[model samples]
Target: MSAINKVLFIAPRFHTNQIGIVKALLNEGVEVEFHVLIKGPTEDYAVLTPIKIEEGKFSRFLSKFLKTQKVNKYYAFPSFFEYFNTIKNFNADLIIIRDPGRFFSIVSTIIAKLLGIKICFYTQETLEIEAKNTFRYFFQKFYKTIFHAEWITPIGGTDTRIKKFLPFVVESRFDYLNETSAIEGYSSEKAVAVIGKFTARKRLIWALKLAQEFDCKIKIIGENTTKEHATVYQELLEYVEEHNLGDNVEFMCNLSHSRTLKELSCSNFFLLTARNEPASISVLESLSVGIPVICPLECGTSSYLTPEKTGYTYRQDDYDDLKNKFRRLLVHVSEDKKIRVECLNSSAENFSEQAYINKFNYIFKRE
Candidate 1:
C-alpha cells in the first residue's frame, strides 16, 4: 500500500485562517482532520469537520495548580483511553497541534511517536521574553525534548527568537506562515485605524497622542475586556476630551470580524502603537486590504514591512521618531490608488493561500 497520506490538526478551535490550509491539503488528495477542544462560532469549512474533545478531570486539576504557580494552562486533556482510541482510528501520517500547552502537547507528542507519525506544533512564544523561573525553564526543556517536532510560526526572527530555549533545532526546520487573503482595493482617505486590546502594553495612549498631534481621523477597534483594559479605556476617553480630539478620533469597540474588515476598507492607512506586539493579525489584515501601516520596531509584524512597498517601522516608544515616520507615510497615502494596490498585492504574494498550501506540501513530503 502507498505511504500514509493523512494529516490531523489538534487545536482549541478552527478559525478562518486554518480553512485555507485544510482546503489546500484536500486539493492535493491528502485527508485532513481536526481534533478541537471547542468549535469556533464561524467555523463552517467544508473540507473537514473537527472532532470536539471533552476535558479530563486530571487536566483540570493540573491546570488550576499550574495557574497558581504562574504556568501556562493545559487545555487539551481528554479521557485517556478514548483519546488513544481516536488517534489510533485516525492513523494520520502527520499531526499538527495549535498553541501547544504543556500537558496537552507533551501527551500528544508521546502518542505521535508511538504511532510513528510526524508531528508539528504552532507557537507564538519568542525568546526575547525569557522564562521567569526554574519551573518554567524546565517545562520548556521537557517539551522540547519530548516533542522534537516541526515548529510553524511567522517568518521574522522566530528562529532566533526561539534559539535560547530550543537550540537543538536547525534553522531550516522553522516553517514561517502568516496567513493572508486577497481583498478588493480601497483608496487612501487619509484616515487611520488601530485594532487591538485596550491593554497598557498595546499603548493606545500613544495612538491617542498621535491623533491629537497628527490631526487625522483615527478609528480604534477594540473594547475593554478586562478590569485593566477598562481603566485604560477610561483614560483614553479622558485624553480625547482634554485634548479636544473628539472629532479626530473614534473608538469603534466590540466589532465582529466582518465589521472590522468594513472599517479597514473605509480607511487609507493602519497604525500600530504596540510596545511589545508579537506578530499582529490586525497588521496583516490591514495589508490584505492594500492599506499601508505605521508600526513601532518592537512589533513583530514590522518584519514584513518593506520601506519600498508595504510600510514603515519606527523606534519603539520614541514619540518623535513615530511622528516623523507617520508624517512620511501620510505623504505616500495621498498619492495614487495604484500604490496602495501594489502594497496589497505584495502582502498577498508574501502570505497567500497558495504559499500556505505549498509549505504544508513540503512538510508532508519531507523524509
Candidate 2:
C-alpha cells in the first residue's frame, strides 16, 4: 500500500538482516539502494561506504558528548560533498536513516531536507515517559519539527503515551529468521536450551541453577567456554564441578547455523538468560524452531511473546521470577503437546523473513 517506487537506506553498518527487506523491495518493483558508513568483520556482502571517518581522540570525545558507543564514528567533513553527490544521484523518492543521534544521521537529514526528499528514521531506543521535562525531550521535539522526519522503531517507542512525544509510531518488530524447519521432536529427555557465550553478562549461571534445583537437563550452546578458555568459561566449569552438574549440563561451541538449529530441534524449551538484551535473535531462532522461549522482560523482543501461547516473560532483575516462569514453562513442555505448533505459528506470524518484509511494506503503506 505504500507508494514506494525507489528508496535509499542510509546506515552506519549493514548486516544480514537487511537482505530480506531488499529482496522484498525488489519483488515489489521498488528499486532499493543502501549506503553504509562502516565495515563489518568480512567483505562478503556488496555495500557502499561513501565516507570513512578515522578513529581518533577527537572522534571519541565527540562520541562521549553524544552518549554513543560508536567511538570510531565521526563526520568526515572532507567527504561531505562527495557523499551528497552520491545521494543526489540515487534520485530516491524516500530516504530511510538508521542509527539516529549520530553525526552521520544528522548530516544525512540535513542533506535530505535540503534536497526536499522525504525521510524516515529507524531506531531501537526505548520509550521513557519520565524524561518528558528534560532538555533532551525538547531537543528531540525540535529535531523532529525542523527535519519533518517521522520516527520508526522495530523495538520500543510503541506505547500510546510516547506517541505524543514522537510524531508517529509503528508498534512492530522487524526480526527475521532464516527459513526454518520447526522441531517436532521435542523430547522429555531433552534439555532446556540456553544459547550464548559463557559471559558474565549473559547470566548463564541461572540456567545452571534451574538444572540444579529442578533436576532437569541443560544445554549451553555457543562459542567460548571450552576446556581451556577465558576465566568465565573456567568459572562455569568450576560451578559444574562443585554442584556435580556435569551430567545435567552440556556445552557446545562454534556450531554451524544448521547444526545449531539441529540442536534446538531437540531442546525441551529455550531460555534467554541475558539481561537488557535490546532484541536477542536467539529468541526468534528458538521460536522459529517451535520451542517456547523464556526471556527477560527488558529484552525488546519480549513484546512478541504471548504468555501460554508463545512463551512467558520475567523481569531480568528478579532471579526468583525467572525460576518461577521457567518452572511453569517446564510443566507445559511435558504436559502440553500443542505448544510446539503454537510457537511455530508465532514465529511464522511475526519473525519470519516474509513477516519482516510485510512489516516494512506496511510502514510505508501507512505513511
lDDT of 1 by residue, 183-270 (tens): 3233333358888778887888888887778777788987556687789899899999999998888897777766776677567678
lDDT of 2 by residue, 277-359 (tens): 76666676677667788999888667777777779999898989998998898888777877877877776666555665555
The number of the candidate with the highest lDDT is 2
| lDDT over C-alpha atoms for residue 230 of model 1 | 86
TM-score of structure candidate 1 = 0.77
Candidate 1 positional error at 24, Å: 4.1
> Candidate 2: misplaced stretches above 4 Å?
1-3, 15-23, 37-78, 128-137, 156-185, 223-231, 256-258, 352-359
For model 1, the stretches where C-alpha displacement exceeds 4 angstroms are: 1-5, 12-30, 36-52, 68-76, 99-101, 125-148, 157-190, 223-228
Worst 10 residues of 1 by lDDT: 165-174
